[model samples]
Target: MHLPLDIDSVKGFLDPAEGRALHDAALAAAVRGPVLEIGAYCGKSAVYLGTACRTAGSVLYSVDHHRGSEENQPGWEYHDAELWDHAAGAMDTLPFLRATLRRAGLEETVIPIVGRSAAVARFWTTPLAMLFIDGGHTLEAALEDYRAWAPHVIRGGTLAIHDVFPDPADGGRPPFEVYTRALASDLFEEVLGVKSLRILKRL
Candidate 1:
């Protein structure tokens, strides 16, 4: 299926190749139930996954507080001043995300949950076909996101994590650690890796 959204126009880190892989993975998983994404930065990944799900008649629930993570804050290497909302005194991506989804005509297929992933997980009871984790980069936040949402994935579902660089020089190890831990737990089996994107099938 053709992606309805223009990935290049969105502000995010996902490579087009990884995004395409995510799209295929989400399409396969959506056969069982709706997909869930931990972060929705300007709807880049959302457009990829959401477009695929929409074609399959499924939905995507994007959970994010719209507050930039540690590395995305001012003075950080990944910080982007364009995302800052001076009036709100915070890093806000909600407006951009909404506009992106609307532009892609995916507003109806992708549902945005404006809150912390952990907080939303507490009340989440639906079984997910796919769970994409790309919210916080810190070890603490990454682990919390996994702990809260991984088990909620139904058996045979997909558990995808982003920014998994095995080499320390390339990037931080938190995401790689999460990938390894998820492997050691024996609850999931590694299936695919597109660049820093890692996909596992829930056991």
Candidate 2:
């Protein structure tokens, strides 16, 4: 299937190789309803997943408050001045996310949810074909994200966690912890791994 936007044009940390792997996995797994993403950021991963969902006759719900996460704050290491809202004194990514969807002609295929993922999860009753969690990397935040959304994935659906680094020197361990917890819970089984991305199937 053809995608309207160039994948390289989007901004985010997802490596090209990993993004393609995610794209393929989402496409294969999304044989039904929407593939939900916990962190939309600037819509980089959204584009990848949205394209696949669209091709599969599914949808992509990109969820985020748009107010940058802790690590994205002005003083944080991953802060992007370009995303800062000076007047509001916060980082806002909603506009860029909207533009990305529009440019990609995915307005009909991708739905943007503006709010903290946990807050949205409170009211989210729909079953997901695939859930991609890349929101916060802190232990508390990562665990919250997992607790709020993991159960919503239907049995046999896919759950993907990004930025998992087993070695502390490589990166934070929150994501890896979530991955391990999922395995221990016996609710999910590892299905695939592409770089730092871990794909598991709800059992």
* Best candidate (score: TM-score): 1
Best by lDDT: 1
lDDT of 1 by residue, 73-144 (tens): 999998999999999889999999999999999989999999998899998899999999998988999999
**Cα misplacement distance, residue 105 of candidate 2 (Å):** 0.8
User: For model 1, what is the alpha-carbon lDDT of residue 124?
Assistant: 88
Measured against the true structure, the TM-scores of the candidates, in listed sequence, are 0.98, 0.97
lDDT of 2 by residue, 100-196 (tens): 9999999999999999988999988999989999998889989999999999999899999999888889888999999999999999999888889
Judged by whole-model lDDT over C-alpha atoms, candidate 2 comes out at: 0.90
Give the lowest summed-lDDT range of ten residues in model 1: 1-10
- Give residue 3's error in model 1 in angstroms: 1.6
* CA shift of 129, model 1, Å: 0.4
What lDDT score belongs to each candidate, Candidate 1 first? 0.93, 0.90
Candidate 2's displacement at residue 197, Å, is: 0.5
Weakest lDDT window of 10 consecutive positions for candidate 2: 1-10
Which pairs clash in model 2?
none
